[model samples]
Target: MNKSAHWIIYVAMLLAVLTVTVIVSLSVGEISIPFKDIFDIMADKESMEYGILAYIRIPRTLLGFAIGGSLSLAGAILQGIYRNPLVEPYTLGISGGASLGVTFAIVTGLHLLNIMFLPLAGFVGSFTTIFLVYTLSLRKGVLSVNRMLLTGVMISFIASSMMMFLMSITAVENIHGIVFWTMGSLNESNTTMIVSMIAIALISLVISYLFATPLNALRLGENKARHLGINSNITIRILFIITSLLTGVCIAVAGIIGFVGLVIPHITRLWVGSDYRILLITSFLSGSVFLIFCDIVARTIISPNELPIGVITGLIGGIAFIILLSGSRKNSRII
Candidate 1:
């Protein structure tokens, strides 16, 4: 088959998987609602099942899909920009910035005034970090990708250190809140926030396609890309901001869920090759599937008591990546 035909087939398969994931995410929870009953329950809003499905699972599912897709998309973009497989969204210090903000909010008890303060704090912190990293990386009217990566790492460490200092000074109860937020959860209920997250995720996906050719050009290295009439710096900068903002929204919306950004894109690349045109959408869809599945496992594994989503992603993503890498190495294939 032609490459385009194969790409379409792959996308169709991923879409089918995403559909299944959404249905399964909505169906699995404290009480199992059969697939057949979900639509009926949606229509019967007065039913208790309707309330559970509508209020709890629907928002959570949507957020999972958005955050998961966005993070993975961000990771893919970052990896392409840096020409590094290990570069994930958090490598840019976005997560650390968001975590620091959450820690601060918990420490100051501002989160108690309103839960919205938590996400607000996280977004502000990430944006501040983005600005700081970008400003520091600028030299003679250029955004240095290498400098930005190093600066981001340094800033991430500083943010973590500051967060630790705050934790050291805060109450034990506050510490628990900070710890839980860092571990991550999708327990948010604000419909507006969930809708916003979904919108941002989709919009970012659309925006990413505009950079697909540039990203593919970048795979040949910046000097070569520039030789081919592609403006490497502008593309990288634009993508960096988009991915950073998208990641910030994910972190702000749903605490620090790890591995979605790192593992999802890596795994998708292994299966689909490094073409950003295919990689972007596949990673987004697979990420949605992976996270939503992990979330389902998270809330149901212990039944009545839930494990944090981060824990599941960490355990699963880390092990899976390691195994895949090992097998690929043995086969003389590279990711």
Candidate 2:
């Protein structure tokens, strides 16, 4: 089939899956409301079912979708900019930085002052680490992709060690909460937070889409892009900042949900080719579907008890990463 036709079909399929997942997620909670009753509850806002759906399920689902999309889009952008298929927010240490910040807040008792303080600390940590990586990776005023990758990896290791130390020293009662936060969750999601996240995701996705042509040019190498009238340095800097902000906000809201940013972009690329315009949109939708599916599994796998969303993603992503690595090695040998 032609690429355009394939793109349409893929998007349609993703939308269908996302719709089904949302409905199933809403209906299959501990209470087990019927699917038909879900709609009826939506129709009648005064009902208790309406309250449940509106206050909890709907907001949580929307937030999950938005955060998932943001992470995937950020991953796609980073991979394109760096020309590295293996790069992701976690690889670049952004999520780790956020995790560290949240851990600090929890250990220091800043969470008691205001619920917003935790995410605020997360954002601060993310941006700070991003800047550090950027500064450290610069060589003669030019950003070196290899340097950046190495710096990010080293910084992530440092952050993880620091996080572990803090966890060890923390009160036993707070350790579970810290561990869960690192693993990620959507239990705290509400309408206001969901709306804000959606807004941020939409804006960032649009901006990233607009940079499609430049990003495509960048794939050919920096000098070539500059010869084609694209400011490679400035573009890279701007995109780096944008992706960092998107990723930081996502981690701040949902904690360090692993693998969505890494896996979803690679998955989308298989279907859509490398055109950022189409790739970005597909990644966003596919990511939304992927994470919502994962979240459903997290919620339902243990019945009344729930697993952290990160644990589910980690198990799945780790296996997928191994498969992809093996496949890539085989392809390289064949070539």
Candidate 3:
């Protein structure tokens, strides 16, 4: 088979897996609905099953799909821009800023007045981080990826410290709220927010594909890419903003879910090679599958007591990355 055929097959298999995962996620919850009844239950609007399927499971699954794919896509783009395997979406402090925002809202009791305030605050915080990083990294009209990375790390640390300080002075219940949110949850039932996330994820996915060639050229280093007539500066700046906004959206909507951004792209790259054409889609699909599966485990693992989705992702993503990294050590490629 030609390379095109192989890529098609890989993508098809990923879609198949994602289909199965979505089915399982919608069916496997506190009240396990049989696979066959899923559609039927969702159709019968008057039934209790309808309420659960329509209001809770479907929306949650959709949000998970969006956030998961967005995070992974952001990670892939960031790694390409920075040419670093260890770089992830959260490495830019988007999550930290969002977490700090949410913590502030919680402690100040602003979230008590409205349901949208938390997410709004989170988005604002992450946008601030993005602005700061972009502004600070600007060196005589050039975007310094090195300075951006370091500045982001420092900002992330500072944000974490501030969040901790807030947690310290807050009431016990407020502390609980902050801690739970930081651990991440898919309990968001807002259909509008869920739909927005899905739209942004798909739009970002398509937009990222437009820059695939530039990303591949970037693998040859910025100066070399410029020599090859690829405007690495413009390309990097655009992608950085796009991916940062996407990451901010994901973090704002879903709280601070880790590992999807960090691990999924790396895993998919190893599976599909470094070509951005296939790597981008595979990382998205893999991330969606992994997160929906983790959500299933988070909800069903304890049966009546759901663990945080972030916890499951951290544990599973960390272990999977470790195993892959160790095996890759035989070849001495950390990525």
Candidate 4:
């Protein structure tokens, strides 16, 4: 098939899979409703069982889809920016910082965080990490990937330590909520978080998509990219902004969900090659699929008890990442 035909088929298949998965996700829980009744409830034609479906299950399923897609796409962008196979949206300590911010909000009796303020704290935390990393990495107007990576690692350790301190000081009753945030749950789905996350994801995707040419130029090395009329400084700065926005927004909504960003792009690159155009788009879809599937397992594994979505993702992602690393190492040795 031509590339167009392939894209059409892929998109159609993804939509179908997502549709079925969403329905299945909605139908599951303490009460099992038949697929037909679930459809009817969605159609607004109504049955006595529609109440719980409408009020409860739908929001959760939708949030799963949104957060899954957003985090995956964010990971794809990070992979491109760092030119690293393992980097994810949270690789820059944005998520750790956001976690700290959320923990702060929770402990401070900030009612807004439980609702709207949590995302704001996440944004603050995310940008602060970005700012610190940039400040530390920029010396004599030069930015090095190694410097950025080291800074992020250091910041993550510090932020995580702060999170632990807050957890220790927190009251036993509220510790559960803060601890849950650290573990990463998609449980706090609401219309507000959904809207905010979607907006950030879409904006970041659009901006990053526009950077395909520049990113490709970047792959040619800093000096070579600059020779081609690509401003390395400008491109890196834009990339930093985009990554911060994506990581911040995701942490705001989902609270430090891991591995999807780190693993998704490397897998996508295996099929889509090095072209950012195809890489970013496919990464978004595949990342969404992978995350939603993981979420499904999280909700179903213990039935009547939801596992933290982050735990399941981390387990699977960690294994997959190891395999990829092994393969990449073999490839490097061959070259």
Candidate with top lDDT is 1
Model 2 C-alpha lDDT versus the unseen true structure: 0.86
TM-score, predicted candidate 2 vs. hidden true structure: 0.94
Report RMSD for candidate 4. Answer: 2.6
lDDT of each: 0.90, 0.86, 0.90, 0.76
Answer with 1 or 4, whichever has the higher TM-score: 1
Measured with C-alpha atoms, the lDDT of residue 274 in candidate 4 is 70
Q: RMSDs, each prediction?
A: 1.4, 2.1, 1.2, 2.6
**Which residue pairs in candidate 1 collide?**
none
- For residues 1-335, what per-residue lDDT tens digits would candidate 4 score against the true structure? 78777767766777788888877777777788878776666667456567667666776666666677777777766666677766776777878888888888888868443577766777788878888888899988878788998889889999989988988988886688787877777766466767666676667778778898988887777788899999988897788777777777777777778988877777767765677766666777777777777877888899878899899999999898777667766433411
Ordered from best to worst lDDT, the candidate numbers read: 1, 3, 2, 4
| Local distance difference test, candidate 3 | 0.90
Q: What is the lDDT of residue 239 in candidate 2?
A: 95
lDDT of 3 by residue, 145-206 (tens): 88999999999999999998998888998998888988998889887888889999999999
lDDT of 4: 0.76
Candidate 2, which segments miss by more than 4 Å at Cα? 1-3, 328-335
Runs of candidate 3 with Cα error greater than 4 angstroms are 330-334
Identify the leading candidate in terms of TM-score: 3
* Angstrom error at residue 88, model 3: 0.8
> Which candidate, 3 or 4, would have the higher TM-score against the true structure?
3
